[model samples]
Target chain A: MRHHLILRVVTKLLIGSIMLFALYVQFHGDYSPGGGFQAGVIMAVAFIIYGIVFSLQDVQRVLPPWLVHKLSALGVLVYAGTGVVSFFTGYGFLDYAALSPHHPVHGQHYGIILVELGVGITVTGVMITIYYAFTSRTPVMDDEAW
Target chain B: MLRTRSLFATVMLAGVFSLLSALLFVTLDAVDVAFTEAAVGAGISTVLMLGTLALTRRFESPPAHTPVIPLFVVLVTGAALVYGTLDMPYFGSATAPAQTHVAPDYISRTPHEIDVPNIVTAILASYRGYDTLGETAVVFTAAVGVLLLLSGLRRRRRKEEEDV
Candidate 1:
């Protein structure tokens, strides 16, 4: 148990560093080795490692199962909401150029950031949720009769 | 002890190979792909598989004999594919057909069409909106599946309580 605690602390620090690096990658994705999908997965991994080390129940104290479920839905909603906004603005679905005709590039940047955030939220939530679900359930262990 | 040693060896070998594959993906200028592969393939998949292993037996029945015919066919096909790569452009060559063809159109027109600096978003949302929608649906479906499974388990627990 003492060893487990040490391992947990080390993994937590490593996860923190990875998450910070993921943020850097998300922002610098155009010029670097990261993007929305990658950064999202990296963030998910931090939570996954946390779940593995300390048990899912402990991780749940930080991010409850309900919050994860809500976040999962919200993530997709954010992505689709952007498209719906585009549709209502008289542009075809997801046409960000029409978002602001005067400054199209700005519109694109805004749209991309929103979409990436959505992706990040969804990936992180779903990955952690899956881990939670699997780990929370009792494993079937058959005892032999003497 | 021998089994534990072999398990460690297998995991180490897999980790090394996963890292090499991630590097290869990076060299190919598929940074996004590389990132996903490294994170999901090397990191998440390995962790999850190891967790499952912990919950299950380490070893199953040993194979009586290795299947040779299918293995030989797969090896030959893989070799042929690798040999075919000799005629292809070097990794990250800007002049490669991949760079010149669809990518250029997406990159160039994206700024003008959507006015977005990130061509990937432009392509994903506007140019390929349908695919993105499908992906979102798939995620929703997975969530729903989880909910159903859990709810069923809860119902079972209630039934047990009533019986008790």
Candidate 2:
């Protein structure tokens, strides 16, 4: 019991720290050593840690499997939608310059941020989903033996 | 007791090697790569492998008949690859082909084109957007595969329930 408690506490601290760091990396990525990929991985690691300490079912409760699936799809939509939006705006696909012809740099920054957020969301969702799938018990075991 | 000691030693060795590789990546200014290697290779991989061992047995019976010739060929090939590394440029050398080619274009044009200081981000999202799309598709495909596999099991369970 003591060991479990210790593991729980340590995992929480690690998760919390990674989350805080992820945010820092996201906002400060332009001038820092971290960015979307790093932040995404860190966020995923936090949830994986949570899954390890608590039961996978408990983790699923917090982030349901269906929600994770939706989020994964939603992330791709977010990314692709941003690009498609640019295209409709008379720019080439993923052309941030045309996003705001008045201030192209600002448009570029905005577009990048949107895309990065998408990457983060998809990465985290998919990673957690993978963990969930791997940890789930096989259905065959559920059948009563004759 | 002796086996536990050896397992601990092996884990420590793997950890050290992973840390060293991460440091090497960092020194080469591949910060993104370094971060991933450090986090996944050193941190998560070791933890997951150890967790698997915990869930399963730590040891397995040795193979009754080892494939000595096949093992020897594999080892030789691996050694040759390592030996070939001697002809490669020194690690982190600026004049290396990796730095000399296209990198300068990426570094110089990124600011003017995308206006992002992080060239890696610019390249990943803008310059090589299609490649990124492919990568995302690959991930999506893997997720679909997992879902399909799991859903098949779910279908089997449903059939069993109906029969009962």
Q: List, residue by residue over A23-118, the lDDT tens digit for candidate 2.
A: 777666666666666666678788878877776767888888889888777777888888899899898998877677899888878887887777
How do all models score by TM-score?
A: 0.80, 0.82
The Cα error of candidate 2 at residue B133, in Å, is 2.2
lDDT string, candidate 1, A1-146, tens digits: 34466887799779889889878766665455556667767887777777767666677888888898888788788888888997898877766655676887666667767776777677777777666666666463323310
Per residue, candidate 2 scores C-alpha lDDT tens digits across B55-164 of: 44445556578769888999999999999998899877989999899999899887877887777777877777767666665666667677776435587679999999
Candidate 2, superposed: residue stretches over 4 Å from native: A1-3, A138-146, B1-16, B47-57, B92-94, B150-164
| The 10-residue segment with the lowest total lDDT in model 2 chain B | B1-10
lDDT of 2 at A53: 79
Relative to the true structure, how large is the alpha-carbon lDDT of every model? 0.71, 0.73
Model 2 has an lDDT value of: 0.73
Interface C-alpha root-mean-square deviation of candidate 1: 4.0
Error of 2 at B98 (Å): 1.9
Q: Which lDDT tens digits does candidate 1 get at residues B1-164?
A: 13443443466567667878999988876666676788878887676555555555555556578759888999999999999998999877889998898998887786566664556656765677668666766766676686677435577679999999
The TM-scores of chain A alone, one per candidate, are 0.85, 0.86
